[model samples]
Target chain A: NSKVIQTPRYLVKGQGQKAKMRCIPEKGHPVVFWYQQNKNNEFKFLINFQNQEVLQQIDMTEKRFSAECPSNSPCSLEIQSSEAGDSALYLCASSLPTGRQDTQYFGPGTRLLVL
Target chain B: AQSVTQPDARVTVSEGASLQLRCKYSYSGTPYLFWYVQYPRQGLQLLLKYYSGDPVVQGVNGFEAEFSKSNSSFHLRKASVHWSDSAVYFCALNSNAKLTFGKGTKLSVKS
Candidate 1:
């Protein structure tokens, strides 16, 4: 089983409200990733971090989303203003990043519902 | 750009029957392929991964995948699937530490 943990398994927010979720990566893992899974089962990669440094992020995330993985603290992803279309499941995964092939372990994910 | 394709959106099979889930990927250089299963309301679980060496790789719960470079495919298979195997299967390619995933295929195993 994966040791990754995500807080607030379910969240409900009104439109234009802020929505935030947190994730705790597995111990000894230095890489973390966040993704959004829609109701249609389509996955979109949002952002990733290696330790406290940002690696990659999408254009949507660059605009409305903010994330950070601080040392000794849980990683967090927050949206400036949640929209109805933003209602989806947010998944967090962690990996060791061996510079070759690395398997990522995922958490249960936080399901967001916008009203 | 890299992309993964799962031809089947849904697949149904009887318990104790063989199974095959087709997957095709598009990438310029060598590709790292992976198969992940997601149960209802749960996160994705890695079934298997293929980097190099053997074309056929074994995974947990009697799952296996065969990689075909010429066909640009990594197809998942199982000898005898149980009802518990019913879930969504995703085919993904790893590039630049990012995962490109297919829409996903929902598998239904009837007992």
Candidate 2:
């Protein structure tokens, strides 16, 4: 069983409302990644962090999504304004530093519904 | 950019029958491949991963995957599947600490 934990198994928000989710990575893991799994089962990489520093992110994340992993705090991803298209399963994964072959352990994920 | 392709979107097999899920990846250099299974309303569980050395890797729940460099494929297989094995299986590629996942294959096992 993975130790990574995510809060709010489900969330419902209307358009223009802000939606936020939190993730607590596994112990001693420094790398955290966020991914969006759509209804069609396509996964899109949103953003990732190495400890408290941003590693990489896509254009969609740069616009409406903001995420951070502060020291001694649960990492969070927040959407400034929710959209119908934003409804999906947000997954958080954590991994130890092992070059490119790091095996990321995933949380149960937060399923968001935007109406 | 590296990408993964799961040729089959859904596969149905009888309980106690053999199983194989095809996966192909496109990348320039050596590839890191992984097989993950997601139960309904749950997170992805790592079935297996292949980086180097042996081409065949064993995973939990009697699952295994073979990494083929010549064919650019990493396919998952199970000798015998149970009804509980039905779920969505995803094949992914790891590059530069990022993962590129296939759309996933929904496995339905009939009892």
Candidate 3:
């Protein structure tokens, strides 16, 4: 299994609360991607990082959702002020530089609920 | 803007039966196509991708997809599906390295 580890299997918080989801990519992978899955099982690509730099980010991600990949610390996506609309499963994936034929390894995901 | 479409929202199939999931996309240039599967309470997993090679691409767990340029479609198929194959499948496109994803199709396998 090309395992990608994510922390905090589940989280529940009130409105305006802050939440953080972490991810550890598979060994040797250099690119990381974050996605948000809503109730309809629809996935929205939030952002992705190539190495330590962010290559692309969606408008929703750039607003309220913040992500960082430090050299020493694990990659993480943090929401500053959580809302009911932010209640969704957050997923992380990592892939090689090739972007072609390189399968992305995904974490199980952290389910967040903002009540 | 780039977009993807998954026609079927949900599909139920019997075990050991053939399966097919339809996907269509709209892009300006040569788009990179991908199929991903997500089990219940799990993350999205990469099944296969097509980025300018043979129109037909094979993926893990005996899944295969054929890309049609004329139709702007990439459909996934399996010869004989197992019970464990039940999950939600998503079709995605990468245009100029930026990604656009479809809603998804939920698959249910019954014994």
> Can you give the TM-score per candidate against the true fold?
0.98, 0.98, 0.92
What is the fnat of candidate 1?
A: 0.63
Q: By summed lDDT, which 10 consecutive residues of candidate 1 chain A come out lowest?
A: A55-64
**Candidate 3: what is its chain A TM-score?**
0.94
In model 2, the Cα lDDT at residue A41 comes to 91
User: 2 or 3: which has the higher DockQ?
Assistant: 2
Clashing pairs in 2: none
Tens digit of lDDT per residue, candidate 2, span A1-115?
8999999899999999999999999999999999999999989898999999999998873488999999999999999999999999999999998778889999999999999
Rank by DockQ (best first): 2, 1, 3
Chain A TM-score for each candidate, in the given order?
0.96, 0.97, 0.94
DockQ of each: 0.74, 0.90, 0.50
Q: TM-score ranking from best to worst?
A: 2, 1, 3
Model 1 misplaced stretches (Cα beyond 4 Å): none
Question: Candidate 1: lDDT over CA atoms?
Answer: 0.94
User: Candidate 2 docking category?
Assistant: high
**Distance from true position, residue B27, model 3, in Å?**
1.1
